[model samples]
Target: VDIEVVQETGSTNADLMSRLPLLQRPVLRVAVHQTAGRGRAGRPWLTVPGGMLTFSLAWHLPQAPQNLLGLPLAIGVALAECLNTLNQNVQLKWPNDILRDGKKLAGILLESAAASEGGTWIVAGIGLNLQVSDELEAQVGRALADAPWLAQMDRNLLLAQLLNALASALQQFAGHGFSAFLPRWNALHAYANQSVHILDHGQILHAGIALGVDLLGCLVLQTEQGQVNVLAGDVSLRPA
Candidate 1:
């Protein structure tokens, strides 16, 4: 994999997407500052120079997988698993949010584009809070978790470990879809067996206990109507 270190970029995901036509192998873009970073549901990603570490990795496959929706969840599992060993407090929020001590620590965004060379290209963008600064918390208007360990650690070694974990997960996903990661994802679920609410556009859709996820990687909620499988989209999950 080729690594491109940039002091700043408008958006690493967009940068890698534009380079997909010329892509032949995996590529990783590390941006110290993203002037126009974006999160899931088109939310603006707030960042401060030296206070956060943001990067996006691009991988190409000959074809798209059957369970494409599960890709982000699988990545979440991989991230939580990788960080859990170093910091037991690391947890995974459904879909693709990485939490620490019950607070948001990192967000993952996965975007895919068709390659001109006849394949599929995926760019996984990650934004992680490196320091719990008052300014950052104020900008987000929410409590956030910081990875002080990551702040003090060598970035190169940290990147190597994260990338390796991602590589292994992606390789496994390519072979088995999401069934292989369902159990792992549930094991690290931040809201496992907890009362949760499924919402769409701020309207409650279902209120129930999170029963982890099914084999197909859909969120299984134990509601009064019995088990309900929720698909990922603009839907949001929160504590009830």
Candidate 2:
């Protein structure tokens, strides 16, 4: 893994994609500051200078397993483990959101290519608010809140820990797929025992939450009626 710490870049993921085609060799690029970052649903991620950890990791998984449907959930577990070393109580929200104290502390975005030949190259991007100011907070709106625990923390050290954890998760996922990591994913899940509303395809699935992710990393919802397995989508917490 090669890290390229730049002052600023227009969407680290975009930058890597642009250069990947021209490079003779395969490599990973990590942009410390992504000026135009983004998230799921093509929403812009506010990446202002100071106190925010933003980076994109590009890797070519040659022998990637086809059943890596729970890769994102596994990444959440890795992030929780990394943050635990910093003494933070972190939990994973479905689809790839990192929560601390019921607020978003970090997020992971994974994008995969069909592979021009055969193998798949994935770009796993991560963003975190280490110490956002009030001015920036106002710009962020209700999407996120200030994380005080991030204050006075070492960004480099945190990044290193998170990368290491993610690397470990990727290795395990590539080898044993979802089955090897589902238990850890369930343990770090924030809404495992709570009621949640699943929003997908203009339909809402209201059900009681069961522990652990299905093969596709979906939230296993055990409603009053029966057990229903939900695949990836947006979910809102309903009062239990």
Candidate 3:
């Protein structure tokens, strides 16, 4: 894997995606200051220099996965596992949100493109709030969460651990799909077996009990209607 750090960028994901055709092996790009980061649904992602960790990993796959939907969830599991080793109880929200004590500590965004020679190229972008500041909170318009132990840890060391975990997880996923990670992911699921709301486009789609994820990594919600397999949507364990 190759790693590069930049003082600032518009978006690490965009930077790597533009170079996908030239990349042969896995590469990691870290941005100390991301000026135009984005989240799910085109929501703006604000980061404070030196207070957040923002990076993107570009990996080439031999072929597209049978299902691409689970990739983000697998990445979330990898991140949660890496953070948990730091003595922090990190949990995963469906799709790719990382939470600690029910507050979002991090988020993930994935983009892919077809390789010119063959197969698919993937870019996984991650943003983690290491030490939230008043400025960040004000910019985000809410109270944000951070890893308390980051104050005592070196950023480079932590980044290395996360990259290692991600590499291992990606290898496993390539071989066995999300089935290999379903058990571990469920164990860390923040709302397992809890009543939750499934929303799409700001409309309530289902109100049901969270049944955890399936082998394909879809959220299985047991609603009064039936067991609904949600491939992608917004889920809230609490009433919205």
What's the lDDT for all of these models?
0.87, 0.73, 0.86
lDDT of 3 at 172: 87
Top-lDDT structure, candidate number: 1
Candidate 2 structure quality by residue, lDDT tens digits, 3-35:
678877878777776665444444555666777
Worst 10 residues of 2 by lDDT: 20-29
Local accuracy of candidate 1 as per-residue lDDT tens digits, 51-101: 778899998878788768899889888887888877788988887899998
Q: Give the TM-score of candidate 3.
A: 0.93
Query: Best candidate, TM-score-wise?
Result: 1
Give the distance in Å from residue 211's predicted Cα in candidate 3 to where it truly belongs.
Answer: 1.4
**Candidate 3 — worst ten consecutive residues by lDDT sum?**
231-240
| Total residue pair clashes for candidate 1 | 0
| Backbone-clash count (model 3) | 0
Cα deviation in Å at residue 136, candidate 2? 4.3
- Flag clash pairs in model 1: none
Clashing pairs in model 3, backbone N/Cα/C closer than 3 A: none
What candidate 2 gets wrong by more than 4 Å, as runs, is 23-26, 134-138, 143-151, 201-207, 233-240
For residues 1-240, what per-residue lDDT tens digits would candidate 3 score against the true structure? 788999999999989999999997889999988999988767788877777789999998988889888889899999899999886779988878898987789999998999998899999999998888888889888778877686468879988898889888898889888887889999999898888887777578888898899887788899999999887744433432
